[model samples]
Target: MTTALIADDEAHLAQYLKQQLAACWPELEIVSVARNGIEAAEQISAWQPELAFLDIQMPGLNGLEVAQGIEGATRVVFVTAYDDYAVEAFDAAALDYLLKPLKTERLLACVARLKAALGRPPAVDESRLAETLQRLLAPPVQGLARLRFIRAASGDMTHQVAVDEVLFFHADDKYTVVRTAQGEHLIRTTITDLAAQLDPEQFWQVHRSTLINLAHLVGTRRDEMSRLFVRIKGHAQELPVSRAYVHLFKAM
Candidate 1:
């Protein structure tokens, strides 16, 4: 029996795919279900399943990153809400794409192709998906990211720090404290507003009062309660990595 892993952010969507897979390939064994790309990567790496159903977009690592992370281990059937550069890359790489919400017929067809591909000595798509992932991991562009200008309360503080340099942004009662390589400064912004403005790829909403730059990420390890903590540069304090955001490091 073929073992499979399914990864998607939405719990309902993952459930839907589970049902579809059960119908399409009753004999198949689903080894694991991951709620996000990062979790998927960890499970895929650990289980090394023969087949994986991966969603193309997610909060932290994204589907492409997870796929590239599990390079030669499994055959991928990409499930994406919409097509983009990643889809084009997948097509060029000769891998299959399954648009979401996954249709039963399309899923069955994909399974059939996977079975065929498995029969033939797996023809791995030796494409540049790794390079694509590297690009995705890079710090996002200026306009695409949310930035705060920091000024000194005293004289001659003309330089404004880029948001990328920030270690963390804390929300006070009426102001947001922006901490960076240089120092901390007060900015008039709300965590909610900043979250909306920030690029999801660059800055992760770790908590209600905190936003962290993935580029500055140093390490993540489970605490006493199986909760995760993230360490960042420019700050000695380790921040909480909520379960909601835990998937961010699964691939890393």
Candidate 2:
């Protein structure tokens, strides 16, 4: 029996996907369901499953981190709600991806492709993957994004800020500010530049100079002008959600 590991932050989605997989492929045995990519990485390293279906966006380490951390050989399939514009890197890397509310046909096709690819030869392009990752480090739009390390200049000079903790990137006058649980910190960068460095699924461009984190969104309400206002947890104020970007937060 083929062993599989699934990693998704949403419990309901994970359970639903597990049920669908078991129904469609009865012969497959699921070894684990990880709630976060960090947990997924640990479980995957220990289990070394033959197949892994991972969600590309999660708190802490994302799916790519989990995939890279696996010890032995294993085929990886990514599932995410990121836009098609951002999927080109996956294609260039020769890895498979499924969009949200996964279609049965697409799932089956990916499974079939995996089986066929496994039987013959390595299907991924290692050179292209390397090139794509290298480009990601420099912050490319619609592609893999990397984080920059920041060090505090004064009191806590040893404190290094991991870019992943940032909840939003906003323009405050001339400098850009990265908001996080700790507080906002000013940085010498443009909001556009920071957006390109952030994962699209985690950070959304609501306005010309504001990017909000999807995970931090508590609730959304319509203002008198029909504009949406998104309330974030741990923050006292509600931020404006542009009309053009309101659709992204509707169902969720």
For each candidate, the alpha-carbon lDDT, in order, equals 0.70, 0.70
Task: Name the regions of candidate 1 deviating beyond 4 angstroms.
Answer: 92-94, 132-252
Model 1, position 17: C-alpha lDDT score: 87
Clash count of each predicted structure? 0, 0
Query: Can you write out model 1's per-residue Cα lDDT over 89-143, one digit (the tens) per residue?
Result: 4653325778876777878888888878877764543434433443444433345
Judged by whole-model lDDT over C-alpha atoms, candidate 1 comes out at: 0.70
State candidate 2's TM-score.
0.53
Which is the leading candidate under TM-score? 2
Candidate 1 lDDT for residue 47: 86
Model 1 lDDT-worst window of ten: 125-134
